[model samples]
Target: MSESGSSNWAIEATDLYRRYGTLEVLKGVSIRLQRGKMVAIVGKSGSGKSTLLHILGTLDTPDTGTVSVCDVPILNLSSTALSSLRSKHLGFVFQFHHLLPEFTALENIAMPSLITGKSKREAFNRANDILGYLQLSDRASHKPNQLSGGEQQRVAIGRALMNEPDIILADEPSGNLDTETSIQVHQLLRRITTEMGKSLIIVTHNNDLAALSDEIYEMKDGMLFRSEG
Candidate 1:
């Protein structure tokens, strides 16, 4: 599908393949994630789980096949267009919180909108709104170091949501958290899918975390298959 057409799925990949010189990473992995669903992918290191995530997020390109996000075929878009699409329609979270150390949580969360040329007032308003939803309104003025690990991660999630993206791509979002914190994050992700109606694809190693998703896949030798059956 392209920008002019409609798609039932939020993200779709067809016969995806990737390689780093002689080492093939993805071997025709294809996946379809419906709107408002959460998907979790798990696999050993070097099994191409992150690679697939990068491609789907449009941070990297695949050697073959096509990927569509929000029904927009992005494989051939110009870098500027791709960047614009990503800013408007996608959000990403990594294992690390990646919040700016010097900025207050509000400023860090407001960054994406500011980068997109939104007014400071507008950006902060949206940031404040999401911070409330994330239960971090009280932490808005705290710096990254001032927040606890779980709080920081929630701020990062708040930042990802500041732009009101349709899809969230998370790579090991709760990897560094304690078990209780990890469970909280997992519940938050699932709540986001149901309540906010945003789709999410998370790459994680925790089977219990994966169990919370609407669908689960595990990468093995660069191929992705359903883990449920």
Candidate 2:
């Protein structure tokens, strides 16, 4: 399957395992996510759901396994190569938003493109497009401290999308928002998947958000299993 070289599957993990000293977090787990679909992962706090997401996102390496994104085998890549691959193909959103407090929303969104060697003008233009898509064009000049929680997260989403990645890995993206804000963020995610044709792997405890996904998987005892439809 690896040599066949197809982009039909955005992410594929085979027999994944992870350990931190004596503690094993993932137990021979495997999952395949198709391109242009939203897959939600849900589980208890210590059920290794976040760990699996990290592995899939290439933020961490598995002790024994293989992860392929866009048909490229991640385990074989050097750290620098992996980082380059991630920047070019994957986007990430976390519960904390992780925006730089001193930078404007537009600057924050443009950082990734700039880091990838794009000129400041080119990055900011792309950032402006994403911010406009997220309906935050008016707030582009505002710093993180000046925006509300929902707006900050929207900026984070814009930052993640600024590079036009093939996949987005979001960990509890709306976890800090109020109920109404959460719903708005969920709707935005759905729109992105549907309109932008990007794949999404969201690790969320919110059942409402999970229900909007194309498929849902549950993590338990360090193993991932599909939920019954």
Per-residue CA lDDT of model 1 for 151-223, tens digit only, reads: 9999888889888889999999999999999999989889988898899999998999899998999999879
CA lDDT scores, all candidates in order:
0.91, 0.91
lDDT of 2 by residue, 139-189 (tens): 989999999999999999999998889899999999999989988988899
Off by over 4 Å in 1: 1-5
Residue pairs in collision within model 2: none
Any residue pairs clashing in model 1, and if so which? Answer: none
Which 10-residue window of candidate 1 scores lowest in summed lDDT? 1-10
Error of 1 at 95 (Å): 0.4
Worst 10 residues of 2 by lDDT: 1-10
Question: Candidate 2's error at 180, in angstroms?
Answer: 1.2
For model 2, what is the alpha-carbon lDDT of residue 100? 94
How close is every model to the real structure, measured as TM-score? 0.96, 0.96
